[model samples]
Target: VTYSRSPASPPDGPAHWRPWRFRMSNDVWGTPVVAGDLLYVTSFEVHALDVATGRRQFKTKDVAWTMAVDGGLIHGSDGPTVYALDAAGGHERWRVQADAWVYSLKARRGTVVTGTRGGGVQGWEASNGEKLWEITGAQTDFETPESGPVIHGDTVYIWKDARLRALEARTGMERWSYPVGDAASCGGVPVRVCAAPDGHVYVVAGTRVLAVDIDAGMVRWHFEAPAVFLSAPAFAPGPAVTGGGVYLADYLGTVYALDATTGKDRWRIATESRQSIEPVLVTGGNVHVGSGSAVYTLDAVTGTPMWRFAAGGEVMGSPVVADGRVHFGSADHVLYTLDAAGGQLRWKLATGGEITGSPVARGGVVYACSKDRCVYALDAVKGTATGRAR
Candidate 1:
């Protein structure tokens, strides 16, 4: 379960390497999801592999751009058809054809909900795929990829026609709505929403960040950013709320730490390049964020730079912190493991294509997907391939 390389070894030289890589028929763009001992990934097909051995348990042509796992079922959608499969065997359990093309899919509390292309949101029974309820009247822009509904506790939050609506998760009944006004016009940048434990839900609209009271469905406070043109077409990462503060990065590579209650700025720092389309990770009193071709670590309290690790390509995915290590992928077709404390390179493994999604670590293995049509499971410490590289 471990590789022979030491932690102090240089990232570049040959070392004892063993990894398990499973190849697929098409490129993998989504991050790999680890549930129990099985790893789930999707391309033109959805494949489940053994996390420790890299053996294919099942592969089904479910063609899903969005997926969720809950209540022993794998829920996904291809166009207008929503399908639920047995998570253990990949057998079709139930399928439903929606009224329009599905834009987002999420499942929880025995309920499967979907946002459609024609401004329709429907809730279905997760156990049998039965239609439970439906709502319409909000336009979902197809150009904005981040407009998916976010489920928090028993409520589901979504944006419709420039208004943020909260719906009952199981019944699809509207609870309350808040108007975002002119801040909804952010050119083409996606709006990022995050529901925090502090009884507030944060939303990034254009140049303004709104903190809405979760219970009252009203704006508690709002912070305005400097006027600038937002022209990025990629997905913007959501804010990280923890330790009584909210940490986030703008499209211009400006990172901000704001007080969760007062919306007052604690600290802010700018990076050399535009921040990547990845979430800002705050862990171990340090903030990790990807920008241009490097991952920067800064002090969480003062926003002072700690260390920087550059990659051959842009670090477009969020860095995962686990067991005192930081793992992430890059557009250079490499998966990197770094020392969390000092930002030194532990190991680097190359895949055939760029990795746009983040890696997940469970047990002692790190799982990641690449555009090269493969999923790699590596030793968390040694960074060597272990199971089988097909």
Candidate 2:
């Protein structure tokens, strides 16, 4: 079905319509990963589709709960097995068994890194699936590595044993480690990390956000919130550091803008919903975040609310900004496009199920996955379906 532009849309808004939908065999909860011309989605299986036509390029039964693509290779894991497949086709290159169930997978710089349940973090050779290094953590639930092996440049950052460790991505050499605090304080929620271009990595540890020196492996500063941070699988509302400021929201619905270098609060504002907020997206001197069923736009520096657009259901997925527009999905089984500056509803499309994954835009096309077990492609500006639905 085609979705035309909303009547309330501005005259300059692009014509919005659904171009095509590719059905999957199982429910899809992850965001569509765009690599070259192929769009990859993982459900109980992995399927690669032609980005323009929505035609199935290939499908594999590898069952990757988490997947990453780098250098023509698709790295993923299911249960205790980690595997790499050729991105051009769905052929398996190599598969290796991990000591525990793998929870996270990252592939970059000829290295495949996995964070496993109870097994800590391990690095493997991407070319051959050979084990290169393993850092064992405590076998307990609270002490195991929480999340990541988040690689930035030549360094990999991970939270294990209540501390953040930085390792060399290729050689598995220890660069440095910083103690963030007790893991139990986070109430069993996994801590996550994000690296910035300003030579610092931000981590959410319990109620505090730590800014660590990327090169020195030391905590530059930390900003503590009044409440614990809330996060979801693959959509952690971690800090967004850009242009000398770090923006984040707490579970209590308070958003803070802090000086990136000093960790001092520049401004803070509370949202209407006293619930968990989605990840913060800062761009063009504004902050975009999702809370409850609404997407809010605030001034990046002043924390002043600019506008809000309400959806039919909770906005669980984070929003992506492209070409002056914001793209996101909601539990109401819809994909929404809004003007980035003014928060006007350019268009909206209903899917068969909840859209908890964020939409991705590339080459003027937007791709989004739904719990309906399908991936839908639409024109970025016009929101029209690009190809025939399959």
TM-score of 2: 0.88
Clashes (N, CA, C under 3 Å) per candidate: 6, 8
Question: Per-residue lDDT for 379 in model 2?
Answer: 68
Cα lDDT tens digits, model 1, 1-390, are: 433445533233223423568778778877888887688888867788876567799987768877888888999988779999999999999998889888788888888878887778888999999999888865465423345676778888776777888888888788888876433475455566777777788877677788888888989888888732232111113443433477777767777887776788879898756545566888777888887888889887788899999999988578999888999999999999999989999999988899857898776578899888888877788776544455
Clash count (model 1, backbone only): 6
Candidate 2: misplaced stretches above 4 Å?
1-18, 138-146, 231-243, 272-278, 385-388
Model 2: per-residue Cα lDDT over 339-382, one tens digit each: 99899888888888999568988766688998888788876776
